[model samples]
Target: MNNNSNLSSNNNKILNTIDTVMGVKEEKEINQQQEYPPLNGQKLLIYVMGTLAQIGFMTLTLWLINLGFKQLLEYNLDVRINTIIVSLFWIFFTIRSRLFSPLDNTRSRRQYDQVIRPKWAPPAFVFPIVWISIGVLRVVSSYLVWQELNQNFLALPLIIFTIHLALGDTWNTIFTVEGRYGLAVPVVIIGPLLSSFVLAYVYGQILPLAGWLIFPSCIWLMVASVLVINIWQLNQKD
Candidate 1:
């Protein structure tokens, strides 16, 4: 009887061990499934639409604020204080508008890689650095323009600058977010590239130093325009 009981106990232990191992395996699979849920076509469509909606709202709000700034400048505010306030607004707007896109994700990066780039295209890493520098130049140059105007935000140069900012954001949406490379070509030309040149000319008229500061961005945008045109031609189907 003692031998039989000892054998039964060993069998039960083996069964329990197998059950535990199977449970752990099942749990791991469940966790993995939860972590990376399947992204179906409908889900992807919803995500894109949602992102577009958010961007649209943001652009509208920014425009309203731009108009509001025009009214605010009409007040008898101190010049230095107004300059600081206006600079802060532009800085916040620039950073937020640029960084609010969904292109930072792995999927977007993959999509960018899948596109056929020009032989002279700069590396993907160069874009952020270039854009950030350009953004800083924009804010500084605008500040200088405002100061040169004697705190006149209603001037033509500042108006052009505001339009330029809007166009830049719009081009980003069309090119990167919407994946409309063909449509993006014209948008890039008439939008940011044209605006850059206009801004350079206007800024130069207002303040020579401001114009020079923004001129490099114009050249950069010119190169970018050519790059986008090539990209559209190469990836016509995409």
Candidate 2:
């Protein structure tokens, strides 16, 4: 009779332990559900639409400003008026987004010459104009991708371009402004190469025109890489 009683007690304990464990798991699941709602199809669509709209808005604003400048120049508008318009436009965007800073390039060039003047570096005139053209192309490509947000095929290229832009900006700041060439060189090399590869894919698969528009950026990146390589070679002795 005592042996049977002990066996019954052991079974009760095991049952109690399992109940406690299941209760804890249920509580955890409930808490997770309360914390983060499931990202259903509607929520995902809203998120993507919001992102594309923002991109389109910003690019359109900048492109309009460029168009305004061109028209002002064609009609022989006052230089001061034109300057003020461009300056204010840039200042607004710069204040809103550090990524769109107008002063970074000037600062970078000044710092670049101060840190090291590579023999292979392009002329001062070349960089600013090339970057300006690239900026326009960036806006164009972004606008194009924004238009095709629902297509799914353009997604990878836009993602790659975003990373490329971020890396390029970071490389400039660290290498040129902060004078951290060791880290910057890798970013410059890898960022552009990755950008080139994605752009090639984009040209073949998704939007050929947009990809062609981005070709200059890739070419400029190659030239920039050569300059960076030269700087590394020349500065190692320092």
Candidate 3:
């Protein structure tokens, strides 16, 4: 059996949604008091594959942003590099989610939250401070094609989603401490999807593009995110 029972049912309900997305099997314990299964060689392989999938997804995200900047905004070099830097930090932290777990009261964890998250958060915080800054970053970074390429209002959703991704760990810690971390997977995924769609609509108004890609983008993200998580899950057997 696996550690699903260790998670709260509420959290499991959310995790169930991720299970639907990733097709992960329930690792039920033979006895209620039984421990999670020990990891083995086969499961480790599966875990690594899942991790690689996540890495590839982040890389693809980088490429998509690059394509949008060049094709739509006609911006190059510094713009692409800056955008990539932001995305890299975002993806880097996300992939290292375990390392940043709020439960991680380790010295390294403090360093990451204080030193690391701050390093990345500033430029992004400044991202929406100016109209052009908001326009350049949010417009193309978001999937909306219709949003204006140079406007202030577009920062609304972009700002929130960024905060959500960053603060999600804090929320998870709260849930875990409250005896509810089990359902972390689903809530994390769905919350972002909803916020993302809203952000897309906001971006559409400011700098409109094809609205059709919004849902598709969400699905892709779901699949991509699950694929990445599955990697770590596979290692749980170890």
> If scored against the real structure, what TM-score would every candidate get?
0.62, 0.52, 0.30
Best by TM-score: 1
lDDT of 2 at 156: 56
Candidate 3's displacement at residue 127, Å, is 27
In model 2, what are the clashing residue pairs, if there are any? none
> Model 2, range 75-169, lDDT digits (tens) per residue?
88787776566555433442233234332321224445555666556655355456655766765665465445542322556555544554455
Model 3 lDDT at residue 142: 50
**TM-score for predicted model 1 compared with the true structure:** 0.62
| Per-candidate local distance difference test | 0.68, 0.54, 0.39
Candidate 1 vs 3: which has more lDDT: 1
Candidate 1, residues 50-79, lDDT tens digits: the string is 456545555565567668877877897897
Residue 45 Cα positional deviation in candidate 2, in Å, after optimal superposition: 33
Lowest-sum lDDT 10-residue window in model 2: 24-33
